[model samples]
Target chain A: MEESSLLPPVVLVHRPPALDFIDEHLSRHSFTALYTHTSLEDSLQDFLSSHAASVRAVVSLGRLPIPAEFISNLPSLEIVVCASVGFDHVDLDECRRRGVVITNAGDAYGEDVADLAVGLLISVIRRIAAVDRYVRSGQWTRLWDYPLGFKLNRKKVGIVGLGSIGSLVAKRLEPFGCIISYNSRNPKPDVPYAYYSNILSLAADNDFLILCCSLTDETHHIVNREVMETLGKNGVIINIGRGGLIDEKEMVKCLVNGVIWGVGLDVFENEPEVPEELFGLENVVLSPHAAGMTAESLNNISEVAIANLKAFFADQPLMFTVQLD
Target chain B: MEESSLLPPVVLVHRPPALDFIDEHLSRHSFTALYTHTSLEDSLQDFLSSHAASVRAVVSLGRLPIPAEFISNLPSLEIVVCASVGFDHVDLDECRRRGVVITNAGDAYGEDVADLAVGLLISVIRRIAAVDRYVRSGQWTRLWDYPLGFKLNRKKVGIVGLGSIGSLVAKRLEPFGCIISYNSRNPKPDVPYAYYSNILSLAADNDFLILCCSLTDETHHIVNREVMETLGKNGVIINIGRGGLIDEKEMVKCLVNGVIWGVGLDVFENEPEVPEELFGLENVVLSPHAAGMTAESLNNISEVAIANLKAFFADQPLMFTVQLD
Candidate 1:
């Protein structure tokens, strides 16, 4: 007890300058920052080499990558607590190789992401945003002729990767009379919805495709030109999943040529740099990669991350630990 | 049978030039327009006097009022077929006094209006429309600081008038983890949600108030300043019902002063002329009275109106007949 009181465990926080959400809540821990400002390149190696042995756990914030090279420097690192739902930014293989455990934000963000997915779908189908512009600009008064939007009821909705977020989306959409289906690696026994082993069949049968899968080598660019072609002219695509899951160039072209009906994108292949072509088109609704972000959800995420870190320091079981295999 | 075949019942269509949806489908029966090219003033009295005896049914299109004066002119008018869900535009007392049966669009618009109500709720809470604007205006790259929106999960949702549209709204919100309650003239026996006898009590208890009631004498200005005050600063109001359902002036003040959280208005007291003050606010999402204007719903509305007219002519039971009692 005397030794423990004298020396508290160290936690290394690696985050972008804008994401200092954990600083206030992490007061109990003996913490060190690897990068305080924008440029992590100048002091990253120096900080890692000096504080390598003392750091017991690293808190990765936002989507900043924690690659193999970064993991190799932290020899005493016992766990990586990611403050996000998607841990694709973290090197799972490296962490597993070093016998390091990883815990993600888990269901902390499931409802929020699912909420955004549903919002985007309805917005695109109903032309909520487009008509908003019309009303705001006083075009409604002048023209009195606004184009009619499509209905969401009984439309075939295909969810890609029915994980925690995707499942929540399906449940929320059920009462709207949407015929829900999915494309996943394997079908679960419990769910009532039809499952396709591949993306093409799912796209071909559905009126709308909602992407909720994680980004990985096998899953990256899963929604390409062919998958969209099969989805056809009347189909709509909604991506609340990672940007890498879709081929952005092909999507833009398809939208331009009317190969697909429309899309609602919260994530883009190159974020904060959306294709300029989308700006002129009324069919596409673009968001600034804000799915999984809300005041309550952010608070929940910080609490989960802090709790996981606290649990690790106390030698207790971690929450939402990732299966490395 | 020979007389019926020789001279079909004449139906009077009193509608604006733009609302000629029934023209193509009404060829089966003899239909005459009161006004063809936007000059109803020129021919209304002449048309009414000339065809009063022959006109068996009046197909009231859009919200053009069928007042007591107009009802008095049509001496032989047996029924008023409203091609809209709401029949407040038709004088109920006069219709009842004259033994004129009234039929409305009924459940044709139930799903679409409910969909828009939910869409507006999510859009207002999540800032979906605002964020889309931010992304479109190239502000996302410059600021990197979009304001956080509130979560919808577990929110206390109070629905006004738990009828067809309100019931569907409540049903759709259930799976999103929203706690549902409602304000109605009487408690609905079949619904599982909690009931509030008045708007004030409902507003006081809930985080979100969705107005789905008809605009009648009892419901006009239902959401006044006092109601908004009771709803508090964190509360949101979504009105897909009608502009008259709320006191628009007070609502504008509440939004401007932050007396309430935000609003999503598809209807205004004077539509096509939304309050200029609401234009600059980020919290309010304005829609152009288009909640029931989806293409599918429009088609459904037309079909239902036509079917009801056919049934009335055939002396079969009418569909969606409004109870005069």
Candidate 2:
């Protein structure tokens, strides 16, 4: 109470040392820097002991894991304002047990992510990346039979999750004449798009499966060999969601064996380390986990994150509060 | 008249021997192939003198020039069913003088071409092809600073022509929150998008310029250096129209000197021989004149071409008659 009257609210940043978004932003709050390039165990414990009690909120960035042990260190943490749509990195059970409210970037990233999803879908289907390669390599002159690509029109697209991002993807794709259906934990009551209760069923029915769900225990490896097999040879997968949503090993096998037509992945299970086999594959379009890496989207997320922190401090209803279920 | 009772209505196949769409699909008519691997002039004249009188229609394919000489050879030429969206290669003045009606593939290739236009636009704006190269080249692991791409949402897009393909591009971009405008001979009454009478104004105001016009006398080199300079550093140009629509030499210079942000070209001024300068550019996404090469669109075009031919023979109204103007 004495500190609140004299000083700004203390906010702790939980991300890698290089991720300076919270350091650069969150200027209004007295954010503590716990990152150390070396001697992490010693310095982190020392810093936590001295400053953890004063930290009222944490600004999570770059999907750094906020485990239970880390949560226990922050005894006075009242809220966590995540700067990403996916807050799976944070321990939901620990947050709920400690009575800490959580708010995410919400719809701040929906449009950009959805835009990339549609872009990837089009890229893979139309063989844009592959064709660019063909043209760049001077193959178009030598090869008369330039590969014919599939059309996006009237293609059945099954969204893995019909959340904010998925909904936007559906809306953007509708004008492209894509038949949108979705699979979620529970069917959205207001949406006109057909809902599938299971991922397997959704995969079996649709020509393309777009992974936009949060990476949870239930969702991890949700798209396995069986689902891919059901999606068949013409099936294309677009993962703008977490990489863990699909079994990376099985996916590589499927891709190599021609079990699936193509894939457009923005994320990978072992990110920054994509499968070497995929490099030569013309059918696949790989991205470096950059679906939400737009200037506008990043700015939006920053604003949303700061807004949530301010709302929490003001004792107002926070925007984009995550239901810890 | 006696031969008409004994055989099918005579049609002339005017295309390279390799492009076999007409030969494979146009079965109902008694068509004559005038292409010879060697001595095209002498053999073509011999073939024309022997069989040209009976040919009532010339099936123009692959943008092969249907010159007045060729048209005059077939004195009985009543119609030209072009198996392509653009009938610019056919001499319009010659057809107008001879009162020979021309029918094009029409809206058959509209959706596919529009889809590719949108796809190329997204690929260029988002740096999808470049990012894919980054990832595939294993640069993401070494370089942490992945290039940020522009968002499609709220982007100001100017379509060079608001015909079937352009209109469809506008429609597809609307749900992405793009503010669409266009430049055409005349403003479309049905569309809600703003219209610009000139190309310069359209290029100056819009963030992205999509060329979807025909290659004609007035439209040749429509996107010149001045138009591109007006587009400025943040602007993107997507050419799904004929290559002649943009001045290729100037475009290459603009791209090299950063006059404009980037370009996504499906057509080149001298295609299959893309400017070597564009090979090194990261911002551009080049396709080898394959925007309308989808199987579905090809089938659609084939059906429309056949339908137009049938309607012509049956003395019914043509499906997609090209007004000689």
Candidate 3:
């Protein structure tokens, strides 16, 4: 830690332990970057209580839950800087009533997430990962021919949430001759692709449905039994969104029964606790909720997070303020 | 086999035992598809000797080698219909000397191969296969974050061939925001992509070098030690073309020494027998020379092969005729 005397007024928060690369940036802004959680000698409660009045800003990394109790402890807390794109774990409603400003890592991990979405889709469709496992495990025999995999060309693709990541997903699939239509919160009139207000209709029409939307009450378990049935037996779904976007149980049933052809999932409802059934499935490709966590993307988002923090300390309008009600 | 009395004066040569689907395609054209090799007793020698004069066209399926001796025995052989795209196994020089016309399944497998090329590239770059294996093997822990992968966006990609497959690879990568370049045999002035006449120079300048060029005398072992070294430590190579296009021994060495980052190969030099060393590699993704062997592509190519045979019997202009020098 740098000498506090040389730095500006302190900011309090928990930092991602792997984020020493951003330490220089934090110090550059001359803010004493105090950790509320990681200090060996201090408890989070003790650390927060001692620094309560002085800490006007707090930076939270990943989806580490920011409790309302913690929010109430810091009376002078004006802004909560989220060091990730998704803020599902952060108590938005509590922060809203507390009048705490919220800023997110915006457009930082967009390209990386979109890239993974596409790669996962292609990997599942072509059985790249499955066949790779086959080859690696010595199952690939000299004379034994590989089973055929579906092609991506001209397959109808329906993207849910045409935001920054979703829009890029649509853009990337365009060149592969995939017929692109989307289901967004609202119809983007200026956009060229067809829009579906209802995802059920979208699922029925497309060969593949990709989830890139946020997790909310309206969107939680958005992909249910009815929607999976509509998607039909040969259909596929790719999720780069939060796990709650789809009813994970229904999806599992759908997959087991061959209700849908296959799925390429980066996020699961109960992540790191993926259903054991999926481990044995050939058609499914599983990733450990890492779509936006590429090395380049981490560096990019870290810069964004630090920049937003610096902006907050400078008394400037935050870079990517979330509209919380 | 269908009754020889009913169909067009016999389409000769062996069929792959697994290709029951092609039987319908051949029967649709009412061609007596004779099987020399798949049959129990009749040898290729005995079968061709007895039917040589009558057989004006021979259907060569898969990569079954057509020896010069066999072509010489088929004294009246006017055309050789190759069911696969690459005709390296066929004695093309002998066919040229014998005034035997050659036709291939042109552009039929182009989209499929190009799709695999992109899919393999993503699988290797994003560590999709490795991660999938990890997830499947129950290695992904909630606390243990997956390692970050390399980003494909804005990376320079040098394609070795700008033919149907190469052009499609370039087209697909464009939307991923990849900067495209080429190293085809000739400078395709019609192409907007920057061309490098020297492949070594292309390898040095680009992050990726994709091989989709023909396997000819000039191109065989074209991607040798010097080129791999030039591509450097972080360089990646994707092969959807023939395995022989690269010096496999050198490639294995480069990968072992970390002279190159990784490789995604759908074709291997010795084929079905991939380097046993590559089996243990986490950095390499291998497919058994099945890049163009998708279900849809097989149906498309079989139609082409059958059509070419029908065209020969009907005295029509040959489709996808290969110019044998």
Candidate 4:
């Protein structure tokens, strides 16, 4: 405790077990890592007030919003190092005003997240989850007429964001002979896939729409009912991005009314609590916000987050910096 | 009925609703397609006896065994046009002895079958089916720690065969960062994947094994108890080939005993009847034998099988000829 108190540039943490370093890595650099809520520990305000201006860095380990009220407590905070790819939870406006630099787990979990996205799409379209249940229930013995699934070969897939995750999915699906097209914030040069300025045109021409865009105010509910209607009865929607990217209520109605064929969701608008109506549908595949929770990716995230902190304390260039609003 | 009887060189079929033409193709070709068993079906011997020496071909529509006795009954049969890829059900020795030609549905369903193989592997490793059931059963509402899945990044995958379907699978998994190696009857010089002359070494090194070889006498039960043991508790097996290629009884035992991690099976030693023990396992994903049964592939099979039959009648080189034992 005496040695840790002498360490420079104290770093505030949300908690441990959610995220942590290897101990030796932090000790070698000599930085004080203070965790906030460690099993009946002090409230965030009390801890922040006690430490005050000494806490120049905050290591965010969870997906809860860091609003103005919370940031106001840590007046001397200079940097926020996030342990996730999506940072929609963080208040960008407040961070920008305070001149707080931000860094995220960039391209570290990209490969693993992309793997789950393709896996989810294949699961929904192939009816793997539904058919597995059928076989487990001894229905295979009684039934010879199992429903056939649509082939991935030559099917058109529309990508919402052609960033790291979307590009990886495109690279993977190309070998299966699927035609790739996308709609993005702006058309990317040097990408051979067709690009549409409008999302509706992208939906009308493709059999599958995969949402991989970052969630922002301008991008909220980007895939609403009208876009889904154009994708039609044979279309499928797979969401690996934030749930707010889609109009979940209308999407549920589309699934129920057969306006769209099926869906595979990993995130929800209100999560740990899914829409109760989606529970019984055979055409849907649901996962509880676990697309990026693989053990390997978690380790990579810890390493990346630690590296950014080390860089910031030494007054060096960051590994990655989020674009402030 | 009178006009149909006047057509030449009768072709015997197992039954209707199996495989057929869309009226115009057969009408243009001017051939008699006789379906032996309809609602009131005749015995195989009785029907063959009635057709006598005029039955010039047999269009195999199902996976039912074509024993030596059945081939002897159709003495005038010049060719057997099968509508499926795997000819394990056909009596290849009997066909060879009787001087009958055999043509299978070659490479037509390769893309679709390959698609399912990748799907099943992802579904098993990611626990897509198990978690899907949990989500549907209202378990997500409780404070439950959902299990995390392994990532596909930089994992080694061993392929059992490096043929059409196997090659396609390797191609698909490459962008996922999975290293591909293989076991085949002989090493293919042109293939880029590392060659394993023996399967034991392949199993030892890889985290996942994908079985995609054809079933034959020399290859039966290639993945036996010893191979499964070497694959170890963390290894996953994905079988898109014939069921007999694996000893199902031993596999069930290995799964029960935790010798291997998980299995994704589409084919079985006994069709329409899976082992009852697998019904309770959460780590397994079972699909009915619908890997190559996509609507698009079915159309391709019908066209190719019909073409082979037409080529046999016209004394032209066959589209494909199975190498008889």
Candidate 5:
């Protein structure tokens, strides 16, 4: 094969240092690469107009929203690679229609997300946020009226999704002396945790149910009124994954009625605008969707995104190609 | 020994359900116990005035500030047993001058305080407080660029004062994959942690230096500028024992100048009033002297307090006796 035809030029639209890794790897393979650091709102037309002739693919980390018009305009763009797991911002159908391959950096943030998940779990169960607020407000003249928060040790933890992130959550919780049980599409390999085939069954048996699975048509709002009721009055629900995986209204009702002891939510059904009712509740601990926002996860996502982009251009097996029929 | 001659009437300042254990234990003897949920400020005078003839000693939970005048008034109060480790609130010198025996619940709250010490250490290092704030503030959007928190795994943790709480901290940190080292007056038993034997040397070698020893005359202001300077820029100092263990003025200067990565303080020299300067600092996490404020600890303290009171009255060996020369 001729060297000229062997490799194609690629453009990465993410942050540098991470892109530097891709640049270094691609240099070894004799491929021409153009790196562009652009914001999501910036006109992609300018970049396409300047580098469309040589740009074979675009690897992005929130630099561009893969819209239908953007996909159609990039004549030479063969693939759109996201440096993150969530593809809600991408126009997947349009990319499929244009025959532009889409890949995402999935499971790259599993450990980081899982760490946040367990951290949130411990924070909420231990009433750390409430205690901190009390101390900060100067209301801690004496010991708190309520008992110190409960320990995570020996509590039964139910995982809603036993995917990579869920498995990692289990691994972290395991050291805390929790008995782990998980609900998923199918049972995972030789794991130590007990697998529950149903969410309600899992919730009933566990003190906490953590949401770590992906949001899909089948998994959407999997935790509803029945599941919350099954989780009982002593149960806590922690959602570090997509908010759509839980029913917010139902959760509020359960929380208010003491069907659940508390909730720690990092992701809500709607971003930025969360339910105002969740604000003052001492039992609830809420975070803006930032469970996977650690620096380590960012680096992991960026590295994975670059590798996927590099692998696609090299005609090798791409790490995380999104299937499109 | 004659049972009636050996027995004495005791007055309990505060009574909880756990006192039943002590009552039951003492019932085997011939001691007369009078329990009351008295207000420390006013009821002590009334109880002493009414029961001075019958009352032989007083058992307390350390909630009452036993003044010298009150001790002078109690003609029948031969011993004052405190159900807490710290006896600073009590007039120890007064007791010694008046020939009144004083016993403190020293080892009772050890495990509980140790638990809180480890909890604060993990909470601060993992950015649990900040993350909780982020969630409740409703500003959670991108996980990236929010906070660059680190995991507790694979870090060098130094403990000052390898006493009960210090040893417990080491045990807890051991499971979290941290290399534990300590400085103490004397080395501890068969533990795997490296004993530094010197405070500055311990702080220099570790990522986190936790103050868990006593704040005696010798250990007061041990974590001063020179020791902190040895800790360098990447170090974190946690004070869970006493505020006097670290010089707050020097700590503020170091924190402002980035001399250390962060500080987690459960105890302050003049707390319930935290230094106003520490309020806005992003590197520090503050608590209002609550390292031993867990519900379990409270119950444990109360139970042990009752036991000590009962034991003193029955002429049995008191569980925790503070010696006064």
Candidate 6:
């Protein structure tokens, strides 16, 4: 951790200013940066043979999956930072065995993603989209009756996890006059919201239950048939968190059977290929996992990722290290 | 006015529960209540021949338009409360010449309609409808590549004619971090918004120009070609006021030529049959003149209308009187 030992070569395997802002900040400290937009096989071969003597750190933007063999081949790789919140693609167990420091860009897109979550909630509850289509299709004139939709006011909103994004969602919904309740690992006293001791109770009581918890081994498929049954027919589910948290097959069944009123999903299990069954369902709203894809969030993520890279090169305490015990 | 002169027999038309709510407060009044839901022809004929002796005032709900002939025929009708805002359908000139006092149910649906106005603005700017359609249509496989639509935050909102509905719109938009400026007959010191002396100046400076001004002889077609041209291409126009205030031909032209980015129209000229030309345009959002059509607004309108009716018989001061010069 000496000052002289801190300066080392780094390789970034992403393109279009992916961690370029981080490179500029670290360049002042005499650290050499080798930028390459290569595929996984090419990046692994290049890093292993060409830059093996000088490379001290590897930063992946989570676009290319780094295999265990690739990580083990880098003898000089002391620190690895993924410029993403989720590190599922990274072989974290191998990194831990090698005694390599690992960090992530957590809490970067919280506000932007939370804003979209509330927007989707409002859009669903108010039927804003249906009304828009009705007006646009020119069928509005022939319609004898307009669809009656309810306002978000006075609705009970439940948050599955009282984490960063969930807290932000609750704060945004506050001004809309919705009563918010949350379930977390442990209750935080700072937030002025009701807390349920268990998830089932929270789902049972709330009109809308939003999934904002992480997708860990313990939390995968948490929203299964039991959860949907507890949610009842009047309930709506909005998922902005990891897709694996909900059982997609059960969700589809519940949606078809009217076990739940509606759903707004931003993520899905085995994404980029949502089920064909979801097509043309009036009660379901879908997004292509871009809840955190706003311009503001892109800037925020880039800035935060840069900060994590800088701290890693400085040999100081990393900002957001993913602790894989 | 003496107490004896103020007390008059009142004819109540359109007896909804809202009228009964008012009657519950004024049941002990000495003035005779003549209930009539007869056809307009029958009511006019009955008033002219028989009921004219007892009918000292006519409290109406604007369901049946009162002809100028009927206003001239009533000898004992001293006051006519229209029981709704927009006295356009009432023969105000005839009533004024005959010295019949006129009142309306103004400011009743202000907050409710304003809520809807802001909702429409958010829905259009955020492209809620387009996203909704994409999801429901099963086209949501990957994240959207489109740029995030404009947010309400840090936008300059210009409210035309800061009357009741306009003021409410300003109040609601305040929470979204918008800078509100308004144009009205005269500026009021009580409001926090800056006053724009002219509509053209307001349109030029604002990102969103909302039409909430009343439709009058002087205000008709106020948001015309000149004002719209001043609004420029990046601006958005939201019309929640009367449709005649906007020049429809000019609006359609502006929308087609890209003189404005988008428009959210709740009221349109010759509504219930929107122009077919507006259907294919992506920039224009339309509603069936239902800005004041929420369940809450409907109840408020009915209650206010009934209150005006009850007050006329109770010798109480009726709310929202029209100024007939």
TM-score of chain A of each: 0.89, 0.85, 0.90, 0.88, 0.82, 0.84
Residue by residue across A4-27, what tens digits does model 1's lDDT show? 435766778877666676777787
The local lDDT score (0 to 100) that residue A122 gets in candidate 4 is: 86
Superposed Cα deviation of residue B55, candidate 1 (Å)? 5.1
lDDT order of candidates, top first: 1, 2, 3, 4, 5, 6
**TM-score for each prediction?**
0.89, 0.86, 0.91, 0.87, 0.81, 0.71
lDDT of 2 by residue, B1-325 (tens): 7657355667777775555655656764444444432346576777787777788888877777788887888888899988887787898999999999999887777788899999998899889999999888877762346677888888899998898788899999999999999999998898899999999999888999999998889999999999999999899999998899999999999999999999999998886689988888999999988888787777777778777877877788888899987
Q: Is the docking of candidate 3 incorrect, acceptable, medium or high quality?
A: medium
Ranking by TM-score: 3, 1, 4, 2, 5, 6
DockQ of all models, two decimals each: 0.55, 0.51, 0.59, 0.51, 0.29, 0.21
| Poorest 10 consecutive residues by lDDT, candidate 6 chain A | A12-21
lDDT of 6 by residue, A146-168 (tens): 65455565689999998878987
Name the docking class for model 5.
acceptable
Enumerate residue pairs that collide in model 6.
none
Q: What is the TM-score of chain B alone in each candidate?
A: 0.88, 0.86, 0.91, 0.89, 0.83, 0.77
Instruction: Give the alpha carbon lDDT tens digit for every residue of A114-170 in model 2.
Output: 989999998998899999988998777623456778888999999999988899899
Q: Least lDDT summed over 10 consecutive residues: which range in candidate 3 chain B? A: B1-10
Better of 3 and 5 by TM-score: 3
RMSD of 4: 4.0
| Model 3 segments more than 4 A misplaced | A1-24, A27-31, A34-57, A73-78, A142-144, B1-7, B40-56, B72-78
Leading candidate by DockQ: 3
Q: What CAPRI-style quality would you assign to candidate 6?
A: incorrect
True contacts kept of each: 0.66, 0.68, 0.65, 0.73, 0.27, 0.27
Backbone clashes counted, model 1: 0
- Model 3: lDDT to the true structure: 0.83
- Judge candidate 6 against the unseen true structure and give its global Cα lDDT, from 0 to 1: 0.71
Segments of candidate 1 deviating more than 4 angstroms: A1-12, A28-35, A38-57, A67-79, A91-101, A142-144, A323-325, B1-5, B8-12, B16-20, B27-35, B38-56, B68-78, B91-101, B323-325
